[model samples]
Target chain A: MCGQNMLDIEGLVLRRGRRLLARRIDLRVDRGAFAYIVGPNGSGKSTLLRVLAGFGRPEEGVIRWSGRTIGEWGGAYRGEVAFLGHLEGIKPMLTPEENLAYRRLLVGPTGWRVPTPSPFFDASALPDLPCQRLSAGQRRRVSLACLEHSAAPLWLLDEPLTSLDHDGVAALGGLLARHLMAGGTAVVASHQPLPPTLVPATVLELGTKR
Target chain B: MNGLLGAQLRMIYRARGDYLAPVIFYVLVASLFPLALGPSPRLLSLIAPGVIWIDATLASVVAFAGLFRDDYDDGSLEQMLLSPRPLELIVLVRVFAGWVSLSLPLVLLAPLLALWFSFPPPILPVLLVSLVLTTGCLTLLGALGSALTVGLRHSLVLLPVLLLPLATPVLIFGAHAVLLAERGLDPRTPLYVLAALFFLALALIPKATAAALRVALEV
Candidate 1:
């Protein structure tokens, strides 16, 4: 039970150019916990998630994973994070399976069995076509499939619901529930409401207090 | 590592046009020199090493300038950054793939260009070896330039200005090696120096590229 809050940020400041977006912020999310970052446009929701995922530097403060600063954790920290930004990260020339396969391989061996073919996108329906041929929603689903195979304990999803259909949302809800049950943590930044099942989650609103 | 390499190779395979464009450009540029310089065999052979080297350098610069641009735009580079694998390792694999796809063809075609330039048969091997070293160095340097400018608009316009200056040492040594070999003198010293530069770039550029990419992502 020691170091229960596996993800911790202390006295954080985030700025976009000279304008301050978030300041003197503190956040902690334990394993299996869920946190929602909700705010209007340009509120730093995406920026916050990007910082949490170790992409950008916070203007001030430290982000600690499992009691170690992310820089100290280095590649070890990256091993535990699966970040999905607005771009989807899908190589359009590659099929969904190819994208997911390479995604899994890039993270190195997690000792987790290769996940049974992703339930997010049906192979029969979509076929083995290049992601370029897939619809935007289909591509989004393909990116979601990467999460299913990632085996990373922490997921920092920035607007993951973008372009997802109702069924896709339901599917994502199911995936989130299963992941939480399996002792995973998720920090999501979104404008849309998450499924009912994901309630009892901490909501961190940006741009309002300041 | 093999998986990353394989994936990159597959990308090169699928995007054949982008890789082939540089090779075709090298061929056209090299062929143009023979036509422009007239049929003087001595003059043709005299300029062969320098012309071939400059063409190869330009071709590689063009091909590799956008190396990280597409990946950066598509967000795949960010995923690569998130991987537990060292960023330097990923950068190395990517540059190696770019070399194999874009530069290797130029090397394979060097013999034909040598024959056209009427290069001495004995110096042909030297030409090939120097090109291999020079191209590898240029690709590594281009990868670094690509990483630095990936975040900016009009990065392609800025790429050559940043890369060509850094590539001069490689060009000088590589061309000088072939020129020496053509004159029946020992080309080993310049070749050795080219090899040292290649090895040194091989050791350092990937790390620098990785750091540049990390900073690029911060913006």
Candidate 2:
């Protein structure tokens, strides 16, 4: 278990358009650990999360997951990583239950028969209408529901707290605790602080920290 | 794979407009030929094969214009990119779902189109066979064009223009196949060529489309 189950980045340089964002960054996060990416607006936190999720290429440097380069791991690596971007990844035409069921099918072996409701809401209380008819906070909860059924080991979440209620935050805190305890690793990019129940192993600030 | 297919089919069902556009467009364009050319059965049947082939080609363009644009905009394309399965297989499933929901209707409507063109009843099966192969080729090729333009703003205006030239070969062979059948000839030569083109697209286009999608996500 020399390289073990961990993410290692070295001399990373990332950019957006013509402007370079961050340079010479190195970090590591082990299994059962959490890393928080924080910075002000336009700080490349989201870009870093995208790179970590294997969506974008770094301008310079190498990222190794569990001792293998992501290119080498390829689909095997993607199968283990669950990504949630700013768009929330839900179809507006499908209900919350339908969304969660489809998500579960993609990441796990579950059939779409009986979808488990979002833990953030009452089981019988979710509206049967399409998610587009729901409020912003409700849609965010549905997006968070993907994390619950994902069963993916590495969660790369960007702005998971964008539109959640107090109860939704608490439920997410609980879910994160369970995932970490089960030996899952998470890399989150957020403008606000996560719930107080869990502490991050590393806080990597992007751009120029004030 | 079954799960992806099921979810995709459900989405296709929910967004009825996307699939319906091609079917409606095909029928409307095919009908215009009979109207615009005057009602001589000899003249209509003579040009029927080319007219229907062109209609299918244009319909395919409409069908595949937004193949990946919605997913790209909504970030589901990003999620699909991250699926554990090979991207090529995922792309193939998507194209297959599109073919079923968008192009199958055109195949089903063959008899009506044949009737309108005064095509002989005996040639109906041949026409259907040519359509199945031609549409499959056009859809696969259009999926590649769609993938390349997924992240661009003007993709809708550009897709058909780029695809029509590339699709010309399929149109020629498919129409020729049916024309031969109408002339009471074997029609096997052009039919074999259409089969080859369809199989070639089947073998190659999904991989290319998947690669294009990966590039689209990068920038």
Candidate 3:
């Protein structure tokens, strides 16, 4: 019921052994906004994104979605968020079409029986025949396709541009722009600047430790 | 309703190598015992129960090695944990898929293997039924073991060590069912006990597997 902000983190801190990955970081992403988290390796950019995706707990401080704590949202509310990490999450053995169908089945609306049988189910439209056989860029595209059908309000992407070629990057940039233009919020962790169209986006940069 | 089950079914069907390998291994392992025991009908029949049970149990363990490994490696496990379905229910579906891919085929081929051992036809039904029931238990138990050892370096060895003891009752009842049927006596007691073990594992292993996955993921 609480729909104030899409995401909010306050006094968040994360530590690995004696080292601080992120220290007392306060960040917020309003509904429909595009935000980028930038940092060098080991600067906790991925860690921050993972925390917001609800994949990890902050050692200190709190993360709130809408107006409630992340843990309080329950499974249904949490399902409204999709995450894409650096690793291509597609199953290597599954054809691109099957991978997309499976992902849709995982996050799609209820009563959505698969083998969706729609023209969109064609594997040819996908970047490759199957994920394992695909080029790195092609695999990333397949994963992106899965993300597009997620129907989630929020997207948490970590280094999504890593293996993408020029065209692939532009295509992804266009998708993110479209997503934000349609009132969806996104938090991206990447070193590259997205296309200019994805403007009005906020940037949070983490400085190197002394 | 369809979301969880559909994802599980796809995972099983698409990973043909992971799914089929264990059943083939089961048949090969079971077949070896008879060949090693030298085609003596009496000896083959006498040891068939033990051979089949051991092979089935070992096959369950082999099949489970990939249960969470694929998901973990591909990063799908995190997505699954974060999905709308309860982790326990999702774990159950994964176990169900594992059973179908690994144990179900074993059950179907069990009778054919029994024939090679000259097992009596009357006892064949009991052998098949016992295998079906016991495999269910092994699948559930194996799921728990796989979840616990998800990221461990020695999970290949650890899984069997963890699961074999828990599978003892299943072996006992399954073999007893064959023994009773061979004498032309009703094996109802052992059959019921095996069924009960299956149901018990079906009821409880999901929660245990879920908890184990949580710990494994955190580590």
Candidate 4:
């Protein structure tokens, strides 16, 4: 459903309550671009990513996906964006498989579906075990499976490395690289530098001057 | 979404405490009238409809607090707003499933609770019907309450303040239906009113809830 349309942000302003976080931020990332959103704490890295994700609206901005404005896209905007954040977005009472399966269904695709475990996440480990019983890392992995199953063209990740072990990080990085290779766009908010292999196509750094 | 509904269904299965709390509260509150008012059958029967209705309303309010809190806590509310379906559909399905999972127990136990209030066999079916329909009204309204107050630290205090005003009319219609049934004064009119309220609430409240949830999560 997407062509080579680039994501464009023109003269954006981001704010939290009364405090202005970023001013007149303009950026452009072509389709399939991997843009690392780097910023110090309180610098609005997450806020900018959120605007792209359509999670929370910014104070003022114009964001377009594949040449369509966010407002014009309406409910269909959700179809193209995948957002994963620090909260893991998994229900504690649901088992990993159940959570993954349910999230897949949440996007409204039809036909028989099943949760497939990823090497990064052991969602297959005790498929019936509720998320509350899983350790923090394990639960985070289950949440990662939600990301793996999504078909959206745009990925917005906010501090997504939380609670992941070394192997999990490698697995995720590999997936990110693969997603870029497959012509998907991503805006990842993280301080960690990308592995040399996928040195992100561009860097969108956010923060007011010191 | 069927996926959301299935997940919600599984969620309630694990939360035995949440499911059982309202029924226990319903019983305890129903039993309170007898102790406080001195167990005269006349007084008990006279106040029975209001007592059960009030308890049910209170139980529904309590049940709704957890409804959207989890969405906020786990950050699923943000994702839910971004679901491919409109936010209204998500709120509708979740609220309907929540009503079934949490409040339906109270509906099933309504007859027994009514008996405690001296509801005779003749009025029992009407009482059940009233409870079922009002349960839908309160739950839809409560879903709106839950959405509007989702992320705030003080949302619990605000919930009742927001919900009670909306809920008062529904309760009156529900209780009056029971009273008319007890007196055999052609309870059909109030019952029809209750059904009308139910359908209106079903049609409209979820859209309001979805709007409120968007404000809560996005703004």
Best prediction by DockQ = 1
- Winner by DockQ between candidate 3 and candidate 1: 1
RMSD of each: 1.8, 2.6, 3.5, 2.4
DockQ of candidate 1 compared with the true complex: 0.75
Q: How many clashes (backbone atoms < 3 Å, residues ≥3 apart in a chain or on different chains) does model 2 have?
A: 0
List TM-score per model, in order.
Answer: 0.95, 0.93, 0.90, 0.94
Candidate 2 residue lDDT tens string, B167-198: 98889999998888988999889999999999
Candidate 4's residue-wise lDDT over A1-210, tens digit each? 334546888889998788889888887777767777888898888778777877666667788789888888887788888888778888888888888777766776631223233344557764578888888988888887778777787888887788888877887887777677668888888877555666767787788584
lDDT of 4 by residue, B10-63 (tens): 778888787788778877888888888997878788888898889989999888
Which portions of model 4 show Cα errors greater than 4 Å? A1-5, A110-122, A125-128
What shift in Å separates residue A68 of candidate 3 from its native position after superposition?
A: 0.4
TM-score of chain B of each: 0.98, 0.97, 0.95, 0.95
Which residue pairs clash in candidate 1?
Answer: none
DockQ sort, best first: 1, 4, 2, 3
Pick by lDDT: 1 or 3, better one:
1
Candidates 2 and 4 compared: the better one by TM-score is 4
DockQ score of candidate 4? 0.65
Better of 2 and 4 by lDDT: 2
TM-score, candidate 2, is 0.93
lDDT of 1 at A105: 73
Best of the two (3, 4) by TM-score: 4
Docking class of 3: acceptable
Which residue pairs in model 4 clash with each other? none
Q: Among all windows of ten consecutive residues in candidate 2 chain A, which has the lowest summed lDDT?
A: A110-119
- Backbone clash total for model 1 is 0
